[model samples]
Target: MRDILVTLLVFGGLPYVLKRPMYGGLMWVWISVMNPHTQGWGFATNFPFAYIIAVTTLVSLVKSREKNSFPLSPISLTLIVFVLWMNLTTPFAMFPNAAWNQYTKVMKIMLMTFVLMMVVHKREDIHKLIWVLVISLGFYGVKGGIFTIRSGGNDRVWGPVGTFIGDNNALALALIMTIPLMYYLMHDLRRRWMRHAMLAAMALSGLAALGSYSRGGLLAIIAMLLFMWSKSRHKMAGAAMLVLLVPLALLFMPDQWGARMDTIGEYQADQSAMGRINAWYMGFNMARDRFLGGGFATYEPLAFALYAPNPAAVHAAHSIYFQVLTEHGFGGLAIYLLLGLLTWRSAAIIVRRARGHAELDWAARLAAMIQASLIGFGVGGAFLSLLYWDVPYYLMAAVIATRAQVSLHLGPERRYARPKPLGRPHLDAAQTGPAKPEV
Candidate 1:
């Protein structure tokens, strides 16, 4: 019953995003490439996804909590409990009403973060979301590519006025995620034409990323590509990477590309870096000053208004760690790092055990995607705030839920009765068995 609902929601966007690579990829076909509108133009926008997510979660929670105590990782539970604790213990959270509001707000994000992963319990659910991303983001990339070319290679041009969403970084990160998906498509493909088409789409997606002129995104995509290459253990793919960079050089080597590339050195010359250093200092001091909890999202604005150089330009701290610490104190930072570390640990287990078939392939593929998302979010968060974004947290939650599911299914001993080992066990072959990938 639950699986059916999840499938329906994912299938809602299949036709539109075939060529593009992100959820925002569907806006290209109907809306003008330059349309500035940002309303939900297709089926299952985030609002609807949120509703479907809510329904699916309630069902899963009710079913699981009623049936048996759902197994949870201590690392995940501790972090979640800590976040709740910080809000409850806020210094000025004296009124019950204020505390209730704060609790609800935190709960909202925490719940929203896990929606995708919670619904995606089976391997098929993961498959469905991959299609969702491919169809939605794929078509958007196609449209974006057309627009980028029309503008004489201006990478900053986002979507049509309002309908087309995604900054350059969003576009790039989406493409980075797509790389593994394409590899999977190729890996799973039985037809030559289908394999060719998937590779073509991958190329177009790369073009779209460069069109965004988002250097950080380009770098993030490169990181994911490097990960894929390292995992392949293939000499040809390694050589091809250098060959691929030639076309990219011609496309992005404009007057500003060099300066944009310098963003890699953000910690040195970038004002954003200096601001982060200042913000980190302030965040640490604030944590020492407010041991339990200081304030929620509302606190940062006040600090920026009072202490920042340009008070009128008040904004988020741009670092997830500092943002959580300043808002919820050191306790929040502890919880934040704990959750991330737990996720990485789980992902590592999955990656190490990824053999070559359906389940292990997914485990390995998702682990890489999660790793890339973490590194991208972490690196990008150094300059931009991602606390409010669903991508990072949702991916993290997926890692947790997926990890638990895979661990249960592939544990040394299955809980249920086991099948007798027939004449020769299928596990003998590296391709068919429990052997890990060479990576």
Candidate 2:
């Protein structure tokens, strides 16, 4: 049944995807993020759904004369440069075979991301893309949250097998990032039941993060909540939700979970934390010497034996900064950091400029939520080697798409002008102050 359903969905959706191209982009995101075929033991498990979807989308996009061209932003440019650097570093990798294999996977992710930028050109397309992400990953979040609640938070939450976020820690990070997107959807989804359902999903997703019992996940959630509340138009309401949700989640988790989190304060004594620190040092030393760095798989035991302070404790570059620092040179790491900075700035610009424009209020809300997601990823990623994870880049694409839509709706006269920093006068008399953030 599972195989048949997945087959039907893919084959049935292909014609529509070929027609719209944008739909193909959404389908690609859904399959890549959700790994729906991995959910059950069926024929669909071996099907090449992503490849088929990508090809169909590419062919359709090339044949069609869609008015929605890719937005030329700093974010997209930096991403292209980053990909080139990634390829350049692979040949110099400590293990060329392993590095090349990893490079191929990373390339696939980047290709689809660019495809997304080209096809997802309208505000409606952006909204549907968000919906695809929310539903794809939220399935795990809602399920994991319920399992945590039922099991008293004794068992760990995990993502699908053979996927990027398969571990307990990774799953927590994905869920944390997803909660904001879910909230964004709730604002525009007119049905009362759908909005309420999204609200529940957000709560459960938070609980599921706690259930993961990851120290980094805990810290990431803290940072996410702080920013979500601070950026919200109505501080009291956002604060109230956090105040209510946090306590309930705490009460739901078992004593063991709290003890695990308590280890954050005693990292010097925790072996895992100590090992990560050692790897971080190795990454720094490798980047300091090797112009192109050691490339992917640089964390080999032999390399650690040569550079690490504690030579015996070789570990993976758990930090994204270190992951890039080791895999690509400092120059590459610099570009990666700049990519994040520009993406953040772009989102901020949207949130500030859209303000209270009734039609574009949805864009403002999305910008805020994407900002919150970045906060979660930034904090969580410091301890997780997820440099190539699709979520962050996908969010970047969404930001660019949303901003373009806002500019289009504003018309030529108001378009192309730099958005004033927040708190200044609105761009035009039509623009109002920030709207009260949706509850």
Q: In terms of TM-score, which candidate is strongest?
A: 2
Residue pairs of candidate 2 with colliding backbone atoms: none
**By summed lDDT, which 10 consecutive residues of candidate 1 come out lowest?**
24-33
TM-score of each: 0.69, 0.92
Q: Over 4 Å off in model 1, which ranges?
A: 1-71, 89-106, 112-118, 159-165, 246-253, 263-277, 299-301, 305-313, 356-359, 413-439
Q: Highest lDDT: which candidate?
A: 2
On a 0 to 1 TM-score scale, where does candidate 1 land against the true structure?
A: 0.69
| Per-residue lDDT over 70-158 for candidate 1, one digit per residue giving the tens place of the 0 to 100 score | 33565457656765666556545323455567667556656544433334455654555555556556666666666666665655645
- Report the lDDT of model 2 for residue 306: 80
lDDT of 1 at 419: 77
